[model samples]
Target chain A: MKQSQLIKGVLEGCVLAIISQGETYGLMQALHHHGFPSLVGGTLYPLLAKLEKGGDIVSIKKPSPDGPARKYYMLTPQGKETFQNFQHQWSQLSGHVNQLIDEVHSNDENPGHPG
Target chain B: MTKTQATLDEINRLTEQLAPADQAYFTDLQLYLSTAGLFYDEAQLNDQLLNMLLDLREANQHGQSARAFFGNDPQTMGNHLIQQFPQPKLRDQLGLFSLLLGISWVFQILSSPQTAGGLSLNLVAFILVPILEICAIILIIRILHTSIYPNNHHQWWPYLLTGLIVTITISLIVILNSWVTVGWTFLIPDPWHTILLAAMAIGATVYLLGALLHRWRHHQA
Candidate 1:
């Protein structure tokens, strides 16, 4: 039941990245649509607090389509930088792993070992 | 159509999983709304409740008293609050209920006769209570997900699930009486289960009655 340290970073990082693209509400809805249900209305409070405190997020009081003011969160330029850095690191790691996997698959098919 | 009725329904939903004292807070909110020239109606009531929730969240976010201290207009403040409110849930209910049940479960397992805690002065239950408390927590989350969350697809299903789960979990000790008897002969049987169940039943009864009473009082007004 323990989430790996990597997954935790990825999930939280992805949330911030998604928020950088738009408002928090839409980000939450998009996450849910993508089957990441971490926005259980409970998990978000602390995560938002942490992200804001970390200077990776900011919230503005904005009106919604329904005529109510909601707090909309977006990334600052610094946050965008953080997002890009994290994305690059993650892609580098995953890409290397993928290449290794592909090499092993091709090796298995070729059976280069002496018979 | 009245704001009061709308507020009542809205408050009912927001504070649905809250206690009588917590419910009273919403009544105080109603009084505030009625002061703003809003005829108490269900729609405006929902609006008010939503506004109050936003106000509370704002207070939490900024660590201030509704952000304006005191010099602001009430209706303007209220409308501003609604523009930024999030949907409400029973976070308070879940917290208190989880805590109480957690204490109870820890008491049961630690006070378990076969355990070393039961063999001694049961101080071990106090110690072991915290140790196993982590697992109880995980179990509690699992319980909420399996036994309670599926019902949240419906509007009132969460309420029913909260009531149902609380009732059933409190009854676990009763149903486990045989196991306790066989496992530990010297441990005296406790009635906390029955007491909590009875208390819960009465609380539910009083709440429903209180709703009707409020309705009657509002009519008389």
Candidate 2:
């Protein structure tokens, strides 16, 4: 699958996880710091809008020290639940994928045994 | 001023503080988002845009350009943002339609030739022309909107086709007004014509105020 498609699938969960930490103002920067460096405001803002629309997150405008009001996003109860579910599902999926990769690595090491 | 107007004014003010390149990019994105449709929740869209502008300014302070901070493809991002906006409520659509129709009706009444007896109008043409004109306007807006993005190709043909269609529709309306006199006619004597115009003007004003109030309340919430 294309890398963007992969990111698309998990980006929502990643956003939820980030918001679940605390009220987040600079979401794009937060996502970038958290390892999704390629994410941009163009992508992040719409995703945040969708999450707000879906009732998973709420944004409150707070006065900024140096500019106009900034939108601070916080996870709703529904968003917290969603993040928890994502965590559980991610753990299971990663575990299965890791086990499969390890098995394939062992098979490759023992080249003649698999055939 | 209404909350929406206040928000828009603030947006414009903040937008000016952007660097020239960032200002240009923000203007393009603003046009794309605002012209995408008539039915989306505009107040919410403005709020989102204001927040975005603020973010862009902050990024610029840290040495990032708008394109760098917001990504290169604004069209795709704009589409995604618009998709998430709440669609206009059905009542709001009906209210807008009524206001448009009311304004058209008043104009038609006032513009029609007045005579000693009364003013006569071809009812069929009077009703059909306004609807067609409204539809034509919406189509023209959509056509113009799609051409706003620089990356969009196949632009000239759409404009040409739209111009041709609009010209034909307008000509048809004019012909119907001038030549087609066979349809049912309506007559309003001088006194009643004045009253009818007054009534329509009032109705349109009410609808306009109601819509503005609704938008203000929605923004507050």
Candidate 3:
């Protein structure tokens, strides 16, 4: 599958995870820092809007020290709950996937060792 | 000014700060986003657009081009963004329809030629023409919105051809309207004609002022 298609499923939770930290630009910075450099404002802003619409997050426009007011995003109580749930689900899914991959690699290394 | 207007003003001011190339790209995106969705939550859409614009400006300051900061294909991105907006309520659509119908009805009354006997109007034309005109307008807007994008490189001939077809179609409809005078004629006597025109003008002015005031107050709230 295309990497973008794979990311599409978890991007909402990833975004919520970032916004849970604080601020809008930090979400972009964090995503880039974590290796998803292709995700830009075009993708991020819409996801942010969707999260806001869903009541998972909220933003307040505050005056920035450098320039005009910036929208600072924060997790609502609902958003926090949703993010915690995501964390639990991701951990379980990743653990299972990793165990299966390790088994496949071991089987490939030791040919004819099935049972 | 309403908050919406204030947000719009801020958007205009910040849009000027973009580099020429970036400005053009942003303008095309703005036009598409604003026009493609007719009845969405306008205030929220503007707010989000402003937020995006601000981010683009910051990225520009860091020497990143708009296409680099905001993806290459605006059409796809715009469609995705528009989907996040709340859909328009039925009442909003009906409100806009009524407003257009009311304004067009008044305009037709004022522009039609008067005669010695009275102001003659075709009842059929009065209702049908406005509806047809509204449909034409929506069609034109849709065409214009779809045809516009920063990367579209088709020649001008197609646009010119489309414009010609639209003009001819509307002209034919109008001419056809004028010829229908059988059971559809309505006449107002001279005194009532004057009174009707005066009343319509006054009503339009009052309604416009009231709407503006309400919007301003709503923003203040």
Show model 1 residue runs off by greater than 4 Å: A1-6, A35-42, A65-67, A113-115, B1-13, B16-221
List the per-model TM-score of the A chain: 0.74, 0.92, 0.90
> Highest lDDT among the candidates is held by which one?
2
* Residue-level lDDT tens digits of model 2 in B27-65: 889988888876777788889999888878778888999
TM-scores for every candidate against the unseen true structure: 0.35, 0.86, 0.85
Residue pairs in candidate 3 whose N, alpha carbon or C atoms collide under 3 angstroms: none
Q: B81-158 in candidate 3: lDDT tens per residue? A: 888778799998988889888877787788665888778877777888778777767777676678776346766744
Ordered list by TM-score, greatest first: 2, 3, 1
Docking class of 2: medium
lDDT of 3 by residue, A8-57 (tens): 87888888888877666547767877778788877887788888889999
Model 1 chain A lDDT-worst window of ten: A37-46
Candidate 3 DockQ category?
Answer: medium
Clashing pairs in 2: none
lDDT of 3 at B102: 85
The residue ranges of model 2 lying beyond 4 angstroms of the native Cα positions read: A1-3, A108-115, B150-159, B197-221
Provide the TM-score of chain B versus the true chain B for each model in turn: 0.23, 0.83, 0.83
